[model samples]
Target chain A: MNITSVPFLFLFLPICLLFYYLIPNKKSLVLQNVFLLLVSLFFYAWGEPIRIFYLCILIVVNWLLGCFVDGKKGTKLGKWIVFIAVLINVGSLFVFKYLDFTLENIGFILGQELPLLGFTLPLGLSFFCFQAISYVVDIYRGKVKSTKNLLNASLYLSIFFKMTQGPIVQYNQFESQLISRKTTWTGFCDGFWRFAIGLAKKMLIASNIGYVVTDIFATDTASLPVVSAWLGCFAYMIQIFFDFAGYSDMAIGLGKMFGFEIPENFNYPYISTSVTGYWQRWHITLGAWFRDYMFYPLTLGPAIRMRKFLAKKKVNKNVAKFIQNLFVTGCIWFTTGIWHGATWNYVVWGLINGAFIIWELYKKPLKNKKLDSALGWLYTIAVAFFTKAIVCTPDMGSAFSYFGSMFGLNGNSLVSDTTLFYFREYWIFIVIGTLACFPIYTKIKEKLVNNSNNSKKVKTILYGIETVALLIVFIISIAYSFKNGYTAFIYQKF
Target chain B: MQEKIKEILGELLIGVDLSSKTLADDGYIDSLIVVNLVSELDLEFDIEIPFDALVNENFNSVEAIEALVKSLQK
Candidate 1:
């Protein structure tokens, strides 16, 4: 069911695209919307046949809740409705995703075993739940009105391109497109090129480097050499970015092909000079979601009240403000950490990011822009490189052991045979993947293709070359896809 | 009111230009700064800026902020 799989690329997508375009564009898109809804449901069912029913129930519940909130807008009932909607969305998420983790922790604390109810989390439960919450909350906020049409709501929640993984498009951002959109030949061609690029990134770069990362991480961390440990961490850092961002690009391109404009999820995050800047670029929609839905509400509502209370008690103004900021930042990072998984390592990873960002916020503003940026880049990369070890490891023990190896604290040698082997095998992939993380290729392509001074013949030749290049990339990616069988996107687990 | 708002912004965001048209959009004033600014404005004007008013347009520029405060006051 993965978009990169043979069946999806050769069969499902082609069939879906053919049928989707067969429907004529009219003033009303009910027929198209209905068709997409059915296709999306089928896509989800392909993987999680039983869970698709649960998804349908959630869609219906959220749709009704949205209508109710809209109907009761500006009333106490509206607030309560939105609250209940959040509870339902979050409650279901907790039951499916976090209940077992919670139970295990409780059992540990009590020194007794507890019977655990194991539930397989539905595909994209985290993403769809967030989308559902945003829909109801936006209705209550009057930012967007609820749609009376159930098909449109269902399509919004289960759109095949964004259902499993997302740029997490907000309801208000997508509501208009659901009503009316145009599918142009130019858009389709652009989308195909973008999809090809994403496929190449995933197949040619991430999948190739991922094998080395897996091999290194699987080795005994206590004996893992310094070079091998660092190589593993660095390779994982590259693997995750290309894996998730490539999937995002494919999703966005698919949306474009279908005449929908999904918001971008990444913005060359590695180029960022600070943790704060990095979050703003990476998983942009999720950060914006947390900011608007979680951060702002907590800060503006409770944090403000707390600050006022502290001010009345004669607390120093800066001290009070710092406390408020600290409280808000702590809450955000804790939730962000746990949201990634029910793992403690992810929790620590989130908190580490939060701590650095807070330090940056409170640190004295740098006066020299150039020097500050250089230092910031170094600081950011170092932090990211270390924290990525935590993300890639199974637990804190393994993470610490891995870190020990990385820093030569484990009596590990600086270079090992395994490290040399990995380098010899994957040097090209490592170099290309590292360079691809930046926007250098995009810049070069833009300069060559978009320079107005280029003659018409030259431009035509450039386009021809570009088309051939994309075709080659697409063919190679497909070959890799067939060889690999089913390489799931890393983000799909979340 | 404008002078008071300007003084507060200057204190919170030192060295940042106040005349820029897209302060929030351009990342000059991020979420942390917005939180600080909101608390300061709440204390200074004794006006609670509603959550819905926290959009980028309301805080993208000094003039936009002034207008938002003015309208909220009414």
Candidate 2:
């Protein structure tokens, strides 16, 4: 069930909170963890019960691997066992996520129909599977001690806060927080405020804009006006920011409420002045996870090699540096895109992003950094918007068609009959939605909160007003939830 | 040595001032600048810093940072 759904927000959360608070203070952590796990299992099993068994299998196998690695700590054979376990974990992901896509493409090229063993993708399979792989790898690397408690480890792997969408919490990061932490009254207040804000963003803004975007995009191309297409795409960009950002905010808020400080996932990304900066702010935890665990390690190898070569003056440092950087950057983006889904469009999206970033890096010697940042940001946003159009499309051919219409290159005139009609309908939402992406509201809230210290009366008045505003937003969001027939979370498909 | 470390910390902190009274005793460096400072120190010195390194026991004063840097240099 979506965190935004009525049952989740009104039913499950209230019940959980009531039980959580009722637990004796000393044993609260154990009680809270148990409640969260049972709820998490129900949450996952809500729509897809078949996938539940597979998830349990993963939990058991990975838990066993962690135990095995911990058991053979001093033995030389332990390393190889860890490797085999990790390989099997990763292998499962590779096959399930990529198998059909690979077979279909290969079959097309080889001029023969490959026997398609059709498989239904388990919900959040890719995300949780990666989480499991990271857990085992961390244990093997001695970054974290292997948990002897399988149930606690299982809870860590399938925690409700991130079971569906993820910041992909690390075992080490989680273990520290999960063991002993007291949730303060202040923390509960903070989490409640954050969750309420996210719910409002999703229900009021994102859901509304999404309707306009979906309406325009889902219409037949022949019936669609050119202006409508642009409007739809623009609306989509806004919808995605609020929808995903809202979800991430709620997840973080939920984590906070549960005494786990889930990392911030979005950081006013729309205001970023460069593509790299945008990536830094957007899906922040995911990007950092890949950078730390994937990109840095890959780059470090070549950097060390270059450091050695430079010590002897054996290689051209500049050339070696460029090649090393290019390879790492390429691989990072390739994985970044592929990690989103098993689609060629996603791969192309990654390549396109990598290419832009590489070009930005290439021109660094000649270009002014600030000017390049501004231009590069514009270029990146433009590229990203169009790439998202590709991502949103079902196939490559239609993506090309969409791209064609975007430029008015397919003999479509800007001032055509269709253009004016779309502009008339969606112009206001398109403009307003774009403005909401930055830190305006956050800045406003900060100002009020900062000024709350000036007077007791003033602080009370301000907080009371803010609470009322939040309550109104919550009510409106609930009202808007049924606009579409319970839109299962976008990240749940991952 | 402590003064030198404070100067470096000042440069790293940008608009914020680090004082003798506030630097170690109070929590003036609790927010954005601390994160940046921690990363810069780690990257500049090439050492893995446990999260606790930012707190009073070792990083409580400028002398602490300098001593930490000197030890790493060794």
Candidate 3:
């Protein structure tokens, strides 16, 4: 079920919370964890009952494999264990997520239709699979110890809050907290406040703008107006950020309510002037996961080892380093792309983003803040606008045609009534959405905190206003949800 | 020994000049730099650092790196 739905918001969460708090303290705290595991399983089974079985099987197998890897840490068995675990996890993902796409491509090439066994994808299959692989790999690499208990492992792999669209919290981040953590009044208040903010973001902001973007994306692009194309593209760009980040906020807030601290995913990524900076800020957990597991290993693997060997033969260190980085980064982005979806367009989007980031990193490192504020920032957003079309479109051909319309190619109108109509409908929201991308409120709060001239009276007044504002946002979000229905997050489909 | 590794890392990673203080904080060691550092150190010392050895404690400073290398050599 959608987390924001009426059933989930009013009935399911209340019942779950009631059961959770009713559990008493006991030996090993296993009782509380078991209650959570059962509740989480029920949560997963709500949307996809059959697929929930697959998730449980994955948890059990990965937990066993993790222990095996840990047991044989210093031997060849450890390496083989990791290889097998990765293969099983990734192979399942391929079968479920990519088999249909792969078969379609093969049919196109061979001029014969293959029997397509189209399987229904499980909810959070990619996320839980990635978590499983990361857990095994982290154990293999000695990054974290294997959790001794299976129930704890199950909870880690299948927790409902983060299961849907993850900030992709790593193994170690929650391991200790799983053992023991507190649920204090302050933490509960903060968690509720955070959840309210995310609810506002999704209910009030993302859903409204999402309607316009969806309409725009659905329109035929052959005769679409240039201004309308640009407007839709920019709207989609903002819509996606808020939609996914909003989910992340609620997940983390839920984590806080349960005395687990989930990491922040977005750091006002739109403010970043560089593509590299953008990656660092956006979906931070995903980036770090790739950096540690994918990028580092690939870079330090035979590719760089061979580069190092060549450098020993009097090759230029700089040249060899640059070539290796290019290769490794290409692979990282390609993986990142496919991880998002099964389509070729996602892959191309990844390559495009990868190309821009590499160019920025090598040609200029975005160190000059003064120059960045002038025109460089606009260039970054422009690149994202074009790239976002590839990401949001159904196929490559439609995406390029949309780009053509955006650039006033293919006999598309430069301006039209449709464009004006959209502007009339969406201007206020567009302004609010655009401004929300920057941390204006956060900056002012930081200023008040750091500035020495601020007094106790000022602090108290500001805090009071903030509390009242939060309550208003919370009430409004709930009201909106009741008036309208739930809107599924864009990233959760990935 | 620490000075030697420091010199190599400073030469290898581009952008800001790195020193003991910067290394200790590890504030500047992005993924790009870490890969290059591992390769260069592996080449210079002719000893492989395992994946587990990529921990913050080992890579946090010149001193930590020197100690790790010394132990690996033994």
Candidate 4:
């Protein structure tokens, strides 16, 4: 059921689009939504036949909870209801995603062998659960009114475009679109162009470079040559960005084709001058989610309380602020890490990122533009390299060994045949991948539009060129997709 | 109230311009600064800025912040 598969591209999407647009009454929102809902359910069930039932029950439950929580704003009952809703959503996520990991650790601590309950995780459980929680919370906070229609609720949480991996659209942001939307020929063309670009990014770039990354990591980290280690890490850095961002582009493109606008996720994250800036651009929706839902709440609630208590005790003002910042940053990162997976490496990765971000906060390296831009970028990339290494490695031991090789700390050669071979094979993809990390195409498009000066002729020519380029990209991407069988998006696991 | 907010923002952000209309959107103030500003405003005005009022629009300018604080105080 990978979206890049031939069946999906040729059969499922074409059929779905045909039926959707073929509906006689384009103005009938209910009919369109009902059609979309059924299709979305079918998409889910097609992938996870048994887990579709779990998703349905959760959807109905959250819909009912949203109903109950609405109009009870500022009351204790409303607060409790929202809390229970969050509990149900997060509890389910915990049971499916984290229970086994938690139990194993507990067993280790208690010196008893505990039997593991092997429950298969449903696809997109993490994503939909977050959306469900946001729906109830937004209702309770009076940000968005609860939908009385179960269809709208189901569609909101289980929309096929965003269900699997997301830009994590907030309920308030998506509620309006669900009610009223317009599908135009122009919009569909634009969506198709975007989807074509995403497909190219994935098939032409990410998948091509990914083979080298996988092969390098499969080698013994301790014996990995320094050049090979660096090469693998560098390739991985590109692979992950294109893989996730490309998927996001496809999802966004699909949304546009259906008259929905999914939020932008990645915004040239690799060009960020600081770690803090990097987070702002990378996986933007997730960062915003953490900021709005977790960071702000913790800051306004416990961090503020702790600060006040420290102030009352006559603690130094700066010291109190520092401690508060540390607490907030620590909590956010710890959760952010574990949210990626039920692995200690992910936790470590999160904490490492958090530490670097906190350092930037205090240092304010770019505040006065004091640090040179080139140096700042280098520093940020260096941090990213180590963090990406941590993410790709299986465990701490492997990560350290990889790092050791990367720095020539391990008794490993500087250059190896593997490194030379990878460079020889993937140099073009590597070069393209690196350049594609920036907004080069966007800049070019902007330049064309700016220079066109409202001339219809120039506009027409630009459009023609864009269309042709997109067609070429699509054809090549289709070829690559066929050559490389179904490759799952990296973020799909998260 | 506007002057008070400007003063607090000035103290926290050092070289940032407080008169800009899109402080948050323009990246003049990040989340850390926003957290500190919220805490400061809460203590200064003795008003709890509800989470719903914590959107970017309310914090994107000194005037907007003043308005949010005034409403919360009421």
Candidate 5:
């Protein structure tokens, strides 16, 4: 069930917390882990009862394989086990996620209607499988030791907070906490506060903007005005960032409540001056995962090997390295795009991102020392404004048309009543969400909380005010949730 | 090796001189620069840095890069 839902907020979470705290065993956390596992299973089952079976089987298989893969690392058996794990994990993902895309393409090519397996993708199957693969690969690499404890492995793979909408925490990151973490009052308070903020962000900000996006997208783009087109796309940027980032905040907050220190996902991504910087900030964990698992292995492994071979053949060193990097870059970004969805739009979006990043990579040394950061920020924003439309549109042609409409090149008016209405209604959300995208709030919070000159009484009053503000935000968010609006998370499909 | 590393870094860096003993001390190389440096060193030194070898200390300075390359060459 969604964390924002009434049942989850009022029933599941409270009951889960009650059982969790009451179930004793202060020192040994075996009982705690099991309790979490059972509750998490119930959570998963509540959403996708069919998917939970697959999830359980996958977890068991990985744990079993992990038993041998750790000690025998680099040996034939260890290497093979790791290979099998990757194949099974990634292979299942490919079949479940991409099989339809492949079949549809083949059908067009062959001039025949192919029978398609209309599969309802198991909830979080891609994420579940990816995490499992990450675990097994870590074991083989000896980054983390394999464990006999099924509960430990299970908990790592199926932690309730991050299971669906993920920052994709690595295997070694919080596994220690899963074993023996000391939950503190401070941690609980921090988690609650973070959860409240994320709830407000999602419920109040994302949900409100989402309505504007849906209305704009639902209107035929052929007649959509230039200003309306731009506004709609920008609204999407706000909707998606707050949506995914809010989910990440909740995940991290819940992890904190469990005394697990999950990593932050977003760090003012809009402030990034470059596409590379954007990737580093936006969906930080996903970028890291691809870099570590896919990009590095591809680059340092096969791509480097090929480049070296080319260099041996008397190819210019710089040229060889560039070619290899470009080739590897293509693969990494293409895979990244596919990971988002089984759509050509996503693939092109991914490619555009990759192309921009590679362009920046080459442009690094050539950057003028005197170039203002505002110019870079403007460039980044313009790029996002154009490219993000592709993610919102159904296909590449529509994305291109939306761009044309934004420029008034698609026979659309410069100003429209719809655009003005949207601006009037959503000005507050747009203002708040856009401002929040910067580091302004974070900076102010840091200065206030970290002001050492403030007396204890002053600090206490500030803290009291902050706590009340957070509660009010939480209460308002709950009201919005109960207001029966469109509330599905954007990233749940991915 | 130090001189050669300085030369390579000089080319990679935008405006800063590589005279400082430590690159990080002067805020010369961010994480992106380090990745580029890894590729440059990989090609120049002809050493494939295992993913595990890409660490902060190894990429911290001119000397550290030189040392990392020498060790990898062995």
Candidate 6:
């Protein structure tokens, strides 16, 4: 269910929170995990019932394999067994997420029409499968102890907070917090505030931006005025940030309310001055995951050789270093972009980011502070949003064509008078959506709410006002929902 | 070594004189600045820094980074 849906907002969350908190202190980890497992399963099954059985079977088999692999750690045979298990999990993910694209490519090459299996992808299959593989891999590496308790393992694999999209928590990072965290009144209030803010971000900002962007993209490129195309692209840029970031905020907030501390998924990525900076801030956990797991390992050979070379000679460091970074960074971005989806668009998106990073790597140094601050930001945002057009479009030709339209090079009306038509329709949303991705407002609110010098009376009055404002925001979001079908979270399809 | 770092930062970050800025400040070479600097440093100095080093001593300050670079040079 969409996080903004009235049924989810009013009924499911409240009831879940109540029961989760009300569990008596006597329940074992087994029971608590089982409770979480059941809730998570129900949450997934509510949207896609037929997929639930397969999802459960995957969870159980993977959990057992993880245990088996962990038990075998340190032996050569154990290493082989774990490797095979890891391959199985990732292979399943690849099959589910990429099968159709793979088959179509094969069909194109062979000049034979293979019947499409038309497999319905299970929700969050990519994320959960990765989580499973990481858990086993970590165990095999002795980075974490294998949990004997199957239910605990199951909960780690299937938690609702990350099941849809993820910060891709490491098994130990999650379980460590899970075992020790306490539910408190203050914590609950904090979580509730976070949830409400995230809900507002999604419903008020993302939805409105989605409405206009969807509308503009729906129009044929030839008919779309240049100004309208640019405006639509701009709106899409803001829409995606808020939509994905909002989902992350809600996921983190939900994790908090459950007394779990999921990783923060974003920083203020838009303000970054470099493509490298953008990756650090955007989908931070994912970047870190790739850096730790993929980039470092792949570059180890060259990196080691480079280190030894540097030790021996006072040779030119910049050129050698740039080459090393370019290679590693190129692979990181290439894999990162493809990791988002199986499409050529995602591949291009990744390469574009990779290219930009590589360009910055070897280009003349940028030192002008005034230009660096404003122009740098504009350039980074433009590059990101422009390439995001690739991420949003289905194919390369359409994206390049739309990108051409952005420059008014496609012979469309350079200044579509109706450009203001979209501005009038989506400007408020664009403004709010852009601002919502930053933490400044939330930080400001925290200072107001937590200032010790404020009188209790003043605090109560401010809290009351804030609550009322949030309620209204919630209502407006609901009212908008009353207008359309539930817009699925984009990441859910992955 | 300090001069080398200055040249590198000046080249990578573009506008700032690393000679003037106190490398003591975290902003001296922010994360992106650090990544660029290290990529250059790795090539120039031929020292491979593990990713975690960026979080630890490598980017903390000029002295810290210099010390790490010198050690790696060995």
Instruction: Please tell me which predicted candidate would have the highest DockQ against the true structure.
Output: 1
- Candidate 6, residues A1-494, lDDT tens digits: the string is 66777777778888888777678634554456668789888888888788889888887887777787775666897778677776887788777877888888899899997777787677888788778877887777667778787777788888887887887887757767656567677777777777777777777788778878887787766567778777777887787777778788888888888878888888889888777778778888777677555665555545546644764676565665665566677777777776788888888788888888777655664466677667767888889778866876678888877877877778877765567767876777877776765677667767776775765765797779888898888677677666654777767776
Worst 10 residues of 1 chain A by lDDT: A449-458
* Sort order, DockQ high to low: 1, 4, 3, 5, 6, 2
| Higher-ranked by TM-score: 2 or 6 | 6
Number of the predicted model whose lDDT against the real structure is largest: 1
Best by TM-score: 1
| TM-score, model 1 to reference | 0.97
TM-score of 3: 0.93
What does candidate 6's lDDT look like per residue over B1-74, in tens digits?
87787677666655444544255253445433555566567666767775446554455555667888887788
RMSD of each: 1.7, 6.3, 2.5, 2.0, 2.4, 4.4
Q: What is the C-alpha lDDT of each candidate?
A: 0.89, 0.70, 0.81, 0.88, 0.82, 0.73
TM-score between model 5 and native: 0.94
Give me the runs in candidate 5 sitting further than 4 Å from their true place. Answer: A364-370, A445-459, B16-36, B46-48
What is the lDDT, from 0 to 100, of the residue A206 in candidate 1? 88
Interface RMSD of each: 1.3, 9.3, 2.6, 2.0, 3.3, 4.6
**DockQ per candidate:** 0.65, 0.07, 0.45, 0.50, 0.40, 0.23
Give candidate 6 regions above 4 Å deviation: A26-29, A69-82, A110-114, A301-323, A363-365, A414-421, A437-465, A482-485, B1-74
> Best to worst by TM-score, what's the order?
1, 4, 5, 3, 6, 2
CA displacement after TM-score superposition, residue A475 of candidate 5 (Å):
0.6
Clashing pairs in 2: none
Runs in model 4 with CA error above 4 Å? A25-27, A364-371, A444-459, B1-4
lDDT score at residue A261, model 3, on the 0-100 scale = 92
Off-target runs (Cα >4 Å) in candidate 2 are A71-79, A219-224, A302-315, A365-376, A413-432, A444-461, B1-74
Enumerate clash totals for all models, in the order shown.
0, 0, 0, 0, 0, 7
Output the better candidate (4/5) by DockQ: 4
lDDT of 3 by residue, A226-317 (tens): 88888888998889888888888898888887777999998898887667767888899899789777887886687667777788788887
TM-score of chain A, model number 4 = 0.96
Supply the DockQ value of model 4.
0.50
